[model samples]
Target chain A: MWQPSIAPDAVDRIACVGAGVIGGGWVAHFLARGHRVTAWDPAPDAEDRLRRLVDAAWPALEALGLADGAARDRLTVVGTLEEAVADAEFVQESAPEDLALKSDLLARVDAAAPAGVVIGSSTSGYRMTDMQRAAAHPERLVVGHPFNPPYLVPLVEVAGGESTHPAAVAWAEEFYTLAGKTVIVLDREVPGFIANRLQEALWREALHMLAAGEATVAQIETAVTAGPGLRWPFHGPCSTFHLAGGEGGMAHALDHFGLENPWSRLAGPALTGDLRDTLVTGAAQVTAGRSTTDLIAERDRRLIAVLRALREAQA
Target chain B: MWQPSIAPDAVDRIACVGAGVIGGGWVAHFLARGHRVTAWDPAPDAEDRLRRLVDAAWPALEALGLADGAARDRLTVVGTLEEAVADAEFVQESAPEDLALKSDLLARVDAAAPAGVVIGSSTSGYRMTDMQRAAAHPERLVVGHPFNPPYLVPLVEVAGGESTHPAAVAWAEEFYTLAGKTVIVLDREVPGFIANRLQEALWREALHMLAAGEATVAQIETAVTAGPGLRWPFHGPCSTFHLAGGEGGMAHALDHFGLENPWSRLAGPALTGDLRDTLVTGAAQVTAGRSTTDLIAERDRRLIAVLRALREAQA
Candidate 1:
């Protein structure tokens, strides 16, 4: 990990290591944001694969309206990792999640990357601390976890390793936001990061249901898409449950049924300062600065609209 | 549980017992659908509460274009359960999820309702088998599990007890679909039902994250609304993972990082004959007779549209 000599906002060139599905996705996203991308991979067919992934994604990107001058033509696949980072303003590593392999690869990138260039790993599960152990300049390495199809899904969980400078974490968060991602900057590491932890939990329950023959895979899925999933995009589980509490809101919800609620069998995160600010700010952003009252109204309006739409479509 | 002498599609009168939050919501939904609703509850203020709920939900329902002749005036809250069910074509029990209480209430409804009428419990967790144990006509009793705010959420998990007639299960499926609800017809019972199990799982992981101080209530939340939550409305976890496999589909996803994937520590439901058909049928409904190829294209198109809308709104 290298520190950035240039300001995060001024980062115009991105170096992508590992030109696979995710790596290609990152490249496509950067290109869509009107940035030059230098990508490198060990596989000989990496360029071909990367091109295809980007091509497949371009129409959708076009549908989203690319930034001025954004085009697939801006991508440059270099021969090696060193060449990819030679003149890069920022580096994003999308290598496999194998800890040893990642740590080794990240160390080499650290050796080659310009000092203070700021390297972010796309590993979903690894703590930046574990992955940064082998890096000579670990302070610049940070985790910038993106969801699948990076060009589409907007969340990027940003965190720094133990040795990493907090400034770098802040810088990665800023850079990702500037690149048009909903950035979640973590002050500490958690296995599976934030999203996956939640996902794994829901998935765990899903597995239990499956193993017990409680429901079919399809049943579990519809339980989501048609039910809770409809509310999820606009409100997190907490906020949704808060809505479920009716006019009483969240506190009453907790007091009445949420806390020690039958489902206490499931786990959750502690409520606190930074996470609170993150949630509040993220929520404000999500709702476009609408008040909770305004949001509640919008959610109901949208839900009714969607419900009507689905009923009509499926009827 | 009672069986309907009338055709499932011919049922125009609905009886809702225990008019609290869930029952009130059911009343609102049935009212919105143009059905003459007869509701009863032990609470003295039940009529006022149910009227308020239907009134509050009316504008949204109106925006969706109410069915012909649909009006809030159609709802009739009676003084007794027997009076409520005397002329009802179907009975929906939304009592609290107390096992013995629900069993007794359902049994009473079975005795009071018109012969051959179907009785459905809106219990979230109790297995239909357990709840039907007290009923003399358990064959007509079915679990009509619904998501919270049942009037707004389109999903309703319909299942039959061990003694329940398969015809009754089919009848409930047709009935709910006609009522403009997406119904998952299950042959057996699973505690927490399917949706709650999935919800509890995700919630469990969220709790773990909290217990460890991994993140805050808000962080765990935004992580969803902004990330996986966006995809969930359009795709279930399985379909989402299938797409995540990048052309490899569900099988490749299972083989690579999914089967024994660290996240496997999470659980799910088992696949079976009737349940399998539900899954497939649900998938088909979710896609609205669209091919997988068409679905992929539609998903990408919609994702890009949502991403663009979010960026513009949040900007």
Candidate 2:
């Protein structure tokens, strides 16, 4: 097992590649934690858009509280990928989900960063085993997946590729934790990891209902926000069922509810033309004439409020 | 079409046919809403268990806010199901999942209740089409499914079967809304209804992961409460993806991320002996030897805190 060249809490320089939504989120998060962040993206307007995204997210971070020296100006936009990682103690790549592009980009980052520095990919779908194939120092490659609006949401899933050292995975987990994140480290690689698999299952089920015309889009949204979604923020599906079993807990739940039920018979529906139109129309009805920009502002507002509420509740 | 004999807002006397967890929760909910509740269950000690359940739930209800004149003494446990429904303005059946048992019980309640007083079944699994088979007055028998801890969680999924009247379905929706619930009325009968289908999909996916040894129970639980679960309380799967697509919304999300992919391949796993053992053991690890009763108390406490937080956030 390889050892981390730099300790997790002592590191102050974070390099971020690809400043789109996810990459820019990482930049904002690292800066808020009082780190010097170097960000690089190929788009001509990447610096402008990245700054705007960070500026939009600042109020929420401020409400959440910043580190001793944290400030947005600590971020430096670099001209090239090599310059970005030239002095970075750690590197995070948030490139597009294309496998070839990610693999090639990770290889370049791996070559430029100091030897033994861990490199994490933010590819939501591809496995690190696949992405690390072209990297020279593959042992240091790991996946550290974060939810959208990473500057706010506390979860980050960390796992290593086949060639990754156990120490590297542990180091990444420690780094995330010290930087104020709740990390889940997987024992072995699983496609889509854990949360995404569970999420996609629900998403696919919703689509099936929409395609079959069994429920309206608004009903689907209400079925969640007004229903199980409330419990989810505190209790997960497993623990929720455990309580449903009464005093007997999960064993009683499994035995009492049985396994082969009608609900389990759901399969992913093929998204056809008619289904696509239904989803588009249904979503429009739910959107209720609000533009995406307007909705984002609303979502961020509510998210910050909810996060503060959760924090107070936990306290 | 059958019209509601009594107006939704005028419902004050409610008959509950079963007094287990779900049934007892209904008792607590209605009692807090200032309704006189009459309940019957066949269990020898059901009264003791039912009252205790309501008492345990009372503090949470009190935190949520009680309707004027609401009191625990307003609940009356009767000797027979027929007596329970005799003078009721509305009847809610929270019977066991056995087809024959529920069918015969609904038939009995039907023979005894005042005419046109709508009856709703809290069956988590059975379709109303099947459950209403033996009821004499099936048109008034609609499904009104609730999440566990029905009082605190504001969602109630309302739907009707093949023989039920559309007017009765509307009446139930209006009543639930007036009595403090967010209702989702399905246009047609769908097995397991809406929320349960979505919940079961996620449950099965978590089980699949557990069975495959890809993640631990703690990891699964943390994966949710820390990750997507935080977002779910306000936003849902569809709207979330809409935001994930950036300024383009749902249509762009669908186009950018193709329909069929690795995540869509999820299917229900068989509950083999080894898998069951793993689940039980993993759950034990999560419980950490805490008694089920202890866990329930903790769950209730946290749930109340979260409900209060959400309320304050919304305000």
Candidate 3:
């Protein structure tokens, strides 16, 4: 078992290979943490796009008490992947979700970066093995899958493949911790890692509920957000059961509800053919007239405000 | 198709059938809403227990801006269910989770309460059909499931069986809305109804992960409370997916991950006998050395404070 350890020094240097939404988030997160970030993307006008994203993210980061002059001074825009990764202690790869493109980029990064640099992939789907195979030093590659807008959210799942160096894993965990992220180390390689896997399960069941006519999309969303969603932030399922058991704990609650599991239609077998169409239609109907961009921006703003309040309270 | 209407005025008079933890919560909620509450429970010292629960709940109610001297003056202790329900506008049944006992109590309540009184069950499990079958006027019985400590939590799931009266449903909805709850009307009857159904699905998956050794108990809790749990309070799974799709919608994200669903093992198959034991053990180990009573009290205190702050800010 590999234990996680954090370095005592401040993380002042960072690099990112892509500057899309996820990559832009990585840049914002590092810059918010007072790390100088160098980023490169193949898209035309990538620097302009990245600067716009940074500007959009600034208020939220500042609201969270993270973005400041010292942190802002560390940001650097680079023209190429080599320029981005060179001399960086930590690198985050957020290239497009293509195995071939990601593998090729890892090979290039391996050649350009120093041996001690930790390369973390932001790929939500691909395993570490897929990207590490192209790297000259496979041990240095790890997956540091972060939720969207890495600066506002606190979870970063750190995973490693068979060839991923234990030291690299430790370094990646430490770096994220110093970046003010709560890191979870994956015991082994798994697709979607941890968060997405749990989310997919929830989405699958939610779609099934919509399809079966049990509840409308609006009611379902309202039920979750107003109910379980309220408590989930403070307690996960298991702790919920512990509390539900009254004085007995999870064992009692499980014994009481355990038998009901098989009887309840949890998830539809699987989505096939037209069932997929039904899901899309249901989702569209539910979210009709709602602006995704507006919602994201609103959610990000609220998150930063809440986190900022909590941080201030702690201080 | 039923459209969700505005909640009715707070019940002027409430009759509580049992005074356990859940029953006591009902007393606190109704009383805090300025209803004259008549509470009855066979358990020895039930009144004392109910009083302690209410005293503890006062801070939470005050935080929600619902606790006032006038609101607190409306509570009345009674010797029997008959006395409690007599001439009441709304009767909230929160008896122990025994089907036969609930049926017997509802039967007696039907005999005693006025014909126009709406009877709501604060049950987390029993189906409305079963509870109503024992009532002389089954049409008056409806499910009004509230989360723990009804005085603080704002969610109230209003569901009715086939035999339940439409008028009763409307009345229950109105009453809950007046008391400041986000009411979700379930069109069809289902075990655990909507909120618990979603919760159970998530819990089942979390247990499977713990049982499979994919993640430790602490990691799983951290993964949620610090990760998606952070955002879920404001944006649910569908909303999150909508954001994940960037400019697109859930459809875009679904198309991207549709294939991965089949390939990924999000959660192990429903937990079996021994796996159930492992899950319980893991939860206990995770919460080891912590007193649940203290935790519950602390959680209640914090929830009250947070909700109060939000309410004050809104004001």
Question: What DockQ values do the models have?
Answer: 0.46, 0.25, 0.18
| Model 2 regions more than 4 Å off | A266-315, B267-315
Per-residue lDDT for B1-315 in model 3, tens only?
232222356347778889876788888877776678889999888888788778766655554456344466578888877888886878889987667888888889988988767788887757889777877778878899987656655678898877887877888887888777889888888777777776666655655565455655566667776677655554566556555655444445554544343323433343334433332333234334244333322322332233333334334
Of the true interface contacts, the fraction found in model 1 is 0.60
Provide the lDDT at B198 for model 2: 86
lDDT of 2 by residue, A1-315 (tens): 566789998899999999998899899899989999999999999999999888877766675679999999899998999999999989999998888999999999999999868898887857899999998889999999998767766788898999898889999999999988899988888878888888888877777676566765667677887778877775677666656666655555655775556774554243344433433343344345445334333332333344445445447
lDDT of each: 0.78, 0.77, 0.67
Q: In candidate 1, residue B170 scores what lDDT? A: 87
TM-score leader: 1
Show the lowest summed lDDT stretch of 10 residues, model 1 chain A.
A258-267
Question: How far does residue B195 in candidate 2 sit from its true spot (Å)?
Answer: 0.7
Q: Which ten contiguous residues of candidate 2 chain B have the minimum total lDDT?
A: B295-304
Q: Write the per-residue lDDT of candidate 2 for residues B1-315, one digit (tens) a residue.
A: 567789999899999999898899899999999999999999999999989878777766775579999999999999998899999999999988777788888889888999889998888867788878888788999889987667766789898889898889999999999988888888887888888888888877776666556766677777887788867765667666655666554545665774555763554344344433433343344345455334433332333344445445457
For residue B314, what is the lDDT in candidate 2? Answer: 52
In terms of lDDT, the poorest run of 10 residues in model 1 chain B is: B263-272
Model 1, B1-315: lDDT tens per residue?
334598977878999998887998899889888899999999888799888777877887787678887889998889999999998899999987578899999989988987788889998777888888888789889989887678778899998989888878988999999998999987567676778777867765765565556777767777997788877876887677556555555545454654343542354344344434444444445446554445666677666555544444444
In candidate 3, stretches whose alpha carbon ends up further than 4 angstroms from where it belongs are A1-10, A67-73, A259-315, B1-10, B67-73, B98-100, B262-315
Task: Please report how far candidate 3 places residue A8 from its true position, in Å.
Answer: 6.8
